[model samples]
Target chain A: MATQRILDFLATRRPDGPCLVLDLDVVRDNYNAFEKALPNSKIYYAVKANPAPEILRLLAQLGSCFDTASVAEVEMAMNAGATPHRISYGNTIKKERDIARAYELGIRLFAVDCVEEVEKIARVAPGAQVFCRVLTDGEGAEWPLSRKFGCVPAMAVDVLRHAKALGLDAYGVSFHVGSQQTDLVAWDRALADAKAVFSALAQEGITLRMVNMGGGFPTRYLKDVPTAQAYGQAIFDALSKHFGNCIPETIIEPGRGMVGNAGVIKSEVVLISRKADNDNVRWVYLDIGKFGGLAETMDEAIRYPIVTPRDGDAAEPCVLAGPTCDSADVLYEKAPYPLPLSLTIGDEVLIEGTGAYTTTYSAVAFNGFEPLRSYVI
Target chain B: MATQRILDFLATRRPDGPCLVLDLDVVRDNYNAFEKALPNSKIYYAVKANPAPEILRLLAQLGSCFDTASVAEVEMAMNAGATPHRISYGNTIKKERDIARAYELGIRLFAVDCVEEVEKIARVAPGAQVFCRVLTDGEGAEWPLSRKFGCVPAMAVDVLRHAKALGLDAYGVSFHVGSQQTDLVAWDRALADAKAVFSALAQEGITLRMVNMGGGFPTRYLKDVPTAQAYGQAIFDALSKHFGNCIPETIIEPGRGMVGNAGVIKSEVVLISRKADNDNVRWVYLDIGKFGGLAETMDEAIRYPIVTPRDGDAAEPCVLAGPTCDSADVLYEKAPYPLPLSLTIGDEVLIEGTGAYTTTYSAVAFNGFEPLRSYVI
Candidate 1:
């Protein structure tokens, strides 16, 4: 939802071309909600979601730790007033040079999914705390993570043992239920895998002390999703069920959930017409597309709520597309999106729930369109 | 195939991180080949494929016209020394203001697929030469363009008629067989559709003079494709078979065919490990992935040939991935790519046949990695 503040900003600035307007006020509130919901778990704000300097500064001021994917993000968080201890290099895939660079920056926390990555960290970032990510089924996630990442739980035991052997702190286990995850039980299943890794490691004389529950928290898109409070309750129950009274230190990395609903992309209807007069479905072309942003619309997943000025009028399903010359630029066609029947050319529409995963996914001058411009106020 | 010049440049420059290195000599040769193949048709280099200023300058100096997708691209073409007459606003979807801007910039040619787009051109870019794009089956293309672009040939006739009535030049009919089209007969089918539009319009006393054979040229990837001579002969035969020697003014927009094989991307293998000891497939993580610049690997459509220093060693199938934290960043998984068993971390690999459609598709720092840096020699 576009906050009144964001709407007001758009009304006043009247920015040219398609751009993303993010509300810091909304981001601040979302951060507070997550903190309240997960009172015991530390919140590592996923920096890849949206690394706008203002958002990073606001999160730093609010005492949120950062989950970074690369050395650049680690530098961004540090530049935004976060100390090295407050940041975790969360990407399981990393170059040895990049690992060394982060280590030189005084960051000790790292993520790994294989013995090879653990060996690199041992050679470079000695004695760093490392967490092995366990694989998840990724059920109920709109943007399901594939097996490209995490190793299986059984492999996790071996990876952690290797980390301990290399003189690094075998931190804990991590798993992602997948991005835009909706089912509450998704966390319960992943937690069971994490607990198994913990038990196997403990029996081998290495006690893991943390469980980095990777980001999967949902953001409201076309439908209402579970609130932060609801997710927090579900996660806490899962932790208790798995660990009993010995709940280790926990961390929740919320990327989309933190800022997804906090921004709106204001775009114009570039064109609207039927393939033929007899064609019942209309094709609605917008200034923004997959390359411009809204890449989550790939595979018709993560359908964002579109707001048209003619909202109250009768609506019909229209095949939505982007302004790029590439055929892959079509955003919604398999499942036509319903828009007002009276929608015409040059009409402005706001794509909501776009704060997260919008700016970063934007291409650099694809088809001569500049990267998605963002204004954080 | 990387020419000796590109390989020599890469060997000498040794640029850090994944970057594209292009050879201008190859593009020049490609342009000459197209000219010899379709001697009667004007060559309009599709600017969206790879808008590198060096490539554009070479094409412009060689008297190549440009098919641009936006006002910015039109300006890029003009800045690269191409005159306004040599540029076509080839995107069917455009903002009315953008149309006015291009018109103000002295662009007199445009592309449209519907009456609504024509109406915009009528209001802002009056009397401009407008070509209506007709739908094609896109049958023999690896990247089959969907119905996102163009309309049925019958609707194209109406679109051109509407353009003529609106004081615009009903100049031509255009159809793209689809990108990376390997079948030489694909153009024959699409030309049949263009001929239908031309015949129908000629019956209504509108003498359309041009047949814009839109880009569908394939670049060699993993598999060898037909030569430019083969395509030209087939297209010429189709024209003779349809128009009976009274050929209309013709244009061929070559995007990929012009530069796809002229460039190569130099990437490093970041890490390599199996999910489990028993797991047969190695997960080979590269410094680049779908978001980084290999976006064509979505659905494993465009498989670029990988050149490893250890190419002669025993080979095994590997699940290739990018360095990003996003799980969707995996390049090839459905059909794993075979790589040298001796390939190791930090070894540089060359992704060949990637001169075009690489830089523009790159995300702007998806995980703090910069866009695919390109060096034209």
Candidate 2:
């Protein structure tokens, strides 16, 4: 939902060109909600979600740690007042040079999914705390992360052992259920794998001290999602079931859930017409599309809530597309979006729940359009 | 294949990060090939494909016209020495203000797929020459452009008539067979539609001039594609079959064909590992992935030819991926690319057939990596 402040900002400022306007008040509220939901676990806010300086600064001031995906992200977090100890270089696939750069930047914690990555970190960031990511089926995720990321549980155990042998701290295990995960128990299956790695390492006299539960938290799109408290309770139960009374020190990396609802994209209808006079579906083209910032709609996965002035009017399914010349620029086609029939060219529309995974994914002048402009209010 | 100049430049410079090295000689050769192939057609270099200033300047010097998608591209073409008369505002989707801006910049050629778009152009850029785009099935394209772009052939006649009614020049008809199109006969069906629109407008007493045969020209990827001469012959035959002696002034928009084979991206292997001990495939993580400039690899559609130092050695299929936190960063998994077994982290790899649709599609800084760097030799 567009907050009253954001709505007022759009009404008054009316900045031209498709831009994302994010309200810091909403981000503050979301941070508080997460802190309240999982009081024990540390909140490592995923910087890749929306690395707007304002959001990072505010989170830093609020005593939140950062989960960085690159050396640049580490610098962004540090520049925003985060200490080196509060940042973790979290991406599993990293170049040895990038690992060295992160170490030079004073980042001590790293993520690994294989012995190759572990060796890179060991060679560069010696004595760093490392976490091995285990593969998850991603069953309930809207975007199923295929086996592109994490290694299997047995491989993770070997990776952690290799890290320990290389004189690095095999401090934890991690797994991402997947992005936009809605199922409350999705973490249970992943937690079982984490526990398996933990038990296997313990047998070899390697005591893992923490479980870095990776981000899979959902954001409200077109449908209602469970609250952060619901997820916290489910995760806590899973941790207790797996580790018994020895629940390890845990951390939650929330990217989308932390910032996905704090921003709204203000766009205008570029064109609206049917393919033919008798064509059932109307074609609605927006100044923004897949390349502009709505890349989450690639396979029509993230159905963003669109607000039009004529919401009360009758609606029909429209084939929505971006302003670019590329055919892949279509946002919603497999499942057409039902937009108000009264919508016409030049009408302003607010796309909500777009605060995350948008600005970062925007191409740099894909069709001579600039990267999606972002304004943090 | 990496052009000799590009290979020499990479070997000498050894750019630190993943970067594209384009040989101007290749582009010049391609321009001449296109000119020789379609002698009668005015060549409009699609600006959306690898709009490096050096390439644009060379094309402008060679007397090639431009197909611009937005105001920025129009300005770029003009800045590169092209006059407004030589540049076509080719994208069908446009903001009314953009049309006015283009007109103010002295552009007159425009593309329209519907009456709504025509009305916008008519209202803003009065007396502009507009071409109505008809739909193509995109049957033979590796990247099939869906119904997101053009309207049906029957409706294109109405669109052009509406343009005439609005006092705009009903210039001609346009259609795209699709991007990375390999079929020689693909243009035949689309040309048939274009002919029907032209005939329909001719009967209505509105003389349509120029057939803007939009780009579908393929670039060599993993397999061989027909030559420009072959496509030219096929298109000429189709034109004669459809329009007979009245084959009006023609224009060809060649994006990928002009630049795709002119450049190569130099990237390093970040890691090489398997999921489990029994896993059959090796995951080859590269410094570049879908976001870094390989977005055409989405759905394993454009399988770019990759060359490594050990290409002739024993080979096996590897799951290729980029160095990003996003799971979708995986380039090839459904059909993994065969790589040398000797491939390992730190080995240099060259991604060929990347001159077009690469730097433009690169994310500004997704996961904190800068956009793909380009160097024109």
Candidate 3:
């Protein structure tokens, strides 16, 4: 995709203020790359990343399933032509009305993480196919999911037994290592626990048809982070070895890994001020804030690269802030300040790797700022 | 305000989800305290904190000035019955159209931080009353506003001189020490710098009419922080001593100090899971995320207390997490686990100190979650 095309498109359409640009070419390439790494498994595009109806429609055209966590997400997928059987309502905290709505809408593949949730689903959607979420022992993982919603392996087996007693179909097992997970060994450990749970359920005359390796595939942000292909292959090999024949189907929900770097939040440099404590270090304020694309990185103590429209060699370090009055409106700190380009007040700065949570999860209509505008390359 | 009455009102009126319950009684008390402490200064309620129309109406009733940072904020204040002359368009990086709109709407007071901004405002709001924002030399302040929008003290005088030449009224000097500023000595140093700027301007035969001191009054969140009264009194004393009889009319803009603790974000507990590494620890998940009530505390590395509906003996520490898929959704780590007394599946938890930025700034409609419902007491 031509960068100038997007720039020109935005300049023509959303010339009033800042806008987020999504690159469909990069998104399709990311989806194909992940599919290539896990050739045998089904790729459930996590619509929580960028739930633009057009993006979801494109993924559906590419033969991708969806992992929806809410009724709204489910409806979004359905609107994009995703069949109920092809979607998984994977969130554990199932609202009673939402569960009833999903069941009425024919969404049967529900993910449950606790005994109480299993009972709730059994009461609401007795015919639903449940995926018992198992807790992984992520002792050294970067982002551990077991701390919040999943049940223990033994408890998961009990949940499966409860589902059997309630005459509900318990057909699969799932585990999320965590979001932005950096360690491949954590996948290996989670797979081992999943296989153990599968065998234990089999001993009780319950056969599992699918094993869902929940999405935590890391997206490339910093140069040192591992690529998506590297992480996908590691999980694919582990699933192949552990649950080779027992599980005929596998589903992977890759949200950020597939779309995080495919979009950029383009904003204008509104103000620049030199720091009084350090004259060399200046602060650049953009026309956006924590309410905009930087919402995901808020308080995460992480930094994203800020690139100016023009390139130069005289780079310095500067703190990047947003236009909001709140003190927490900073976008990046101590970022490598771009060199003096042939740009002035209205020049744009493209903040990359914001595709995942930038638009679908964080943009608000506060201060009358315009919502994100998208384009297909 | 009666907490029980407010709770009952919200239970009936608030939408079925995570929402904010704003109490105007507490806000009135806060406003009066700040007004009493700075008896001589004109108080401007920063609308960026909680810009709900009801909040603005209450502040207007209290005879406070309106400090608007955007055109929408200015419109909100005006819609709440504030005269344009009582409103100050105080943002440093403003669009040309917004400036033009403010000028057309008859807003007189404006803040200018740089030479470019002065030129822009001159072209847009030539009849506006302008104040050159000076960067203070006081380091170690809690929230430094100079890092993003203000000019150095020496350069500020030059900008003021230019503002006078551009056929605009260079009214006086203004400086923001920072948000949630706790250091009294920093205010002393900033006041001293402002006095020096005042003397230099006076020598040039510029009789200033207003010395606007930007807001940084600390709100009560953690116990160790000083009260708003202490900070307000210190500022008043510093300004009176430095300028003596030649003091210009004092102006202050308080955002969080007036409304930070005046509201509570009430959410229901959906799911709970114990940590794998520590058997004694558990994690309680709420429907809100970092995108909701916890937006202000982002990256601050601070924890807020969570109060259960039915108080009980504190159990072991449990981490509180949000419904977002990100691992950074953890709201409080090692929070004293309030015993789940009478707290079954759908019990409510009150998260406080969310009145400031919770709704106006961070409540994104993610996962189909609508913005919060507001009720004034």
Candidate 4:
């Protein structure tokens, strides 16, 4: 749920423009809930999802390990009071300079999928605790992860062995089931793949112990996703089934699930005119769109639950768009949303489950729109 | 064609990261050429296309008015030494505050599609020169832009009437044939639509004066486009055919066509590894991707002419991707681009015709990566 009381409170106070509201209290509760469910698992919060300073500060205070994809994220983790030991450079495709800089900033843990990246890490951060990201089919996921990352299981074993030869810590394997992954079986399948890689590395006499299950845990959006407890149980079952209950020091990187529900975006409806007299598609133009903060609306891959203030009025299917002059700034064009017919100019359109990818994906200066602003309570 | 000598010079000088290089001299040439072709048409350079200070400054020096989409763009135009009277607030969806601010900053002309925006503008910018943006089919464009703007021609007349009633200048009719429109027939069709609106508005005694044929002029990309002179001739012939010799004062908003060819992005080939032994698809990772600067590759909409070092080797079809850890960051996963098999890490990939919409569309902190850097030569 969006916690209507908080949203109502926020709308009354802030009226300048579109902004994301983040609640640290909700963050703390979500963190504790995840921690309680998976007691043995280390929570490495992915910084790329929502790297708000206050959010990172709260997570850092919660003894959260950081999963950083870039040098700036590593530095952000450190600046948020996380020691280098708590930050893992999880990006496989990184420049050698970024790798070296992360190492200089005291980050020792890195993730790599290829032989070349392993060599770069070895050259930059020798003896770094590096893990091989193994490939999975990314089946039954909304945002499929089969492309753009990971190596095949057979190649992953060699990458790990090569890591050991290059004076690097050949830590365990990692895999992602893609972002907002709907299917629970995907985790089990990925865990099994991780186990296969682990077994292959063990056969080579290279004892790897760290298993980083990369971020895929879905957050509550337009649809009700499987809860954190369900994910936790599935993860636990997968770990037990794969490792025979002798689980490695398991790491779960939760980016969206940790902060997604805790935030809401408040945007005003700029125009709510039907595109044409005969046209049924009412174009509801909002101040924010793809270039503003809703980049995940690409093909409607991630649907943020939207709510208007005028709820009692009859609803009509409306195509929503952002304020930018670009034709591509439309949010929901194909899918005509049933918005309240009473919703008009200046009416609040609160977007829920928008914390994670919203703020970080905005195109700065796109059509002269300011960067997406976020406020924490 | 790209100035290869300048590109070679840039690659030799800048080896730090991916950069979009803007040639101000080229911008000046393109501007002069367009003005020479369409001597009577007022050129309002769309600031959203590039918004580089140097580029804006050069255009401003060449006596170009700016078509501003947002408050920041209006301010950018002002900062570039453009008078407020010279800046037309072209974005239909805008905050009331932004309208007031623009009015306060002395912006007189504004674009509107619906009644709500017209009313809002009348309230904030009373007696402002308001243009009615009438809708068209937006046909035959490379990047089709039917959604997010304009109203029916019938609604446009009412909108203009309403604007006049509210003490505003009901100025004109505008229709975009979308960006990078391939067919010249789209313009003729849109011009006919504008003529209809013009006749309708003239009968209503609104006397709309400007025919704002919104931007659709294509720039050179991977494929060759019709010359600007060809577009100017078509536009002139269309105006003569519709409005006759006594046509109203015209305004053309050229965003991409004006600045796109003046820029090129030089990005380093980060990594290239065969995805699988049997799979012929090689994954070529670049320092820049969709989020970094190439957001137009959403569905491979904008194909830049990519040139790499070590040409003439055996060509292999490779899938290009950005450096982000996100799996969705694959740039050309579906479109397997043929590149030199000898291409390796740190090799330069010079992307031509990337000047417009490149630097302005970058996500600021996407995965902790730096914003797309742009250098003006």
Candidate 4 docks at the CAPRI level of: medium
Cα deviation at B323, candidate 2, in Å, is 0.7
Residue-wise lDDT of candidate 3 within B149-247, one digit each (tens)?
677777777777788889889888888887767788777777787787777877998766777888877666654677767777777678778878776
Ten residues in sequence with the least summed lDDT for candidate 1 chain B: B184-193
lDDT of 2 by residue, A259-363 (tens): 999999999999998888899999899999988888888778889999998998999999999999999999888888999999988999999999999999999
Q: List, residue by residue over B4-65, the lDDT tens digit for candidate 4.
A: 65566685786488888888878888899889878889999989999989988999999999
Residue B269 lDDT in model 4? 85
Q: Judge candidate 4 at residue A18 and give its lDDT.
A: 86
Model 2 residue runs over 4 Å out of place are none
- Over the true interface, candidate 3 deviates by an RMSD, in Å, of 3.4
Tell me which residue pairs clash in candidate 3. A299-B299
RMSD of 1: 0.9
Q: Distance (Å) between predicted and true CA of A351, model 3?
A: 3.1
Rank order (by DockQ, best first): 2, 1, 4, 3
Q: Which of 2 and 3 is the better model by lDDT?
A: 2
Share of native interface contacts recovered by each model? 0.86, 0.91, 0.30, 0.78
All candidates in order of TM-score, best leading: 1, 2, 4, 3
**Residue B328 miss distance in model 1 (angstroms):** 0.5
- Across residues B1-377, which tens digit of lDDT does each residue of candidate 2 receive? 88777877887887899999998899999999999999999999999998999999999999999999999999999999999999999998999999999999999999999988998999999999999888889998999998888889999988889999999999999988999899978899888888888888788898998898889898998899999999899999999999999988999999999999998999999889998999999999999999989988888989999999998999999999999899889899999899999997899999999999999899998999999999998
Writing each residue's lDDT as its tens digit, candidate 4 over A221-263 gives: 8778888888889989999999996799889899888998888
The candidate maximizing lDDT is 1
List the lowest-lDDT window of 10 residues for candidate 3 chain A.
Answer: A334-343
Q: Please give me the DockQ of candidate 3 compared with the native complex.
A: 0.37
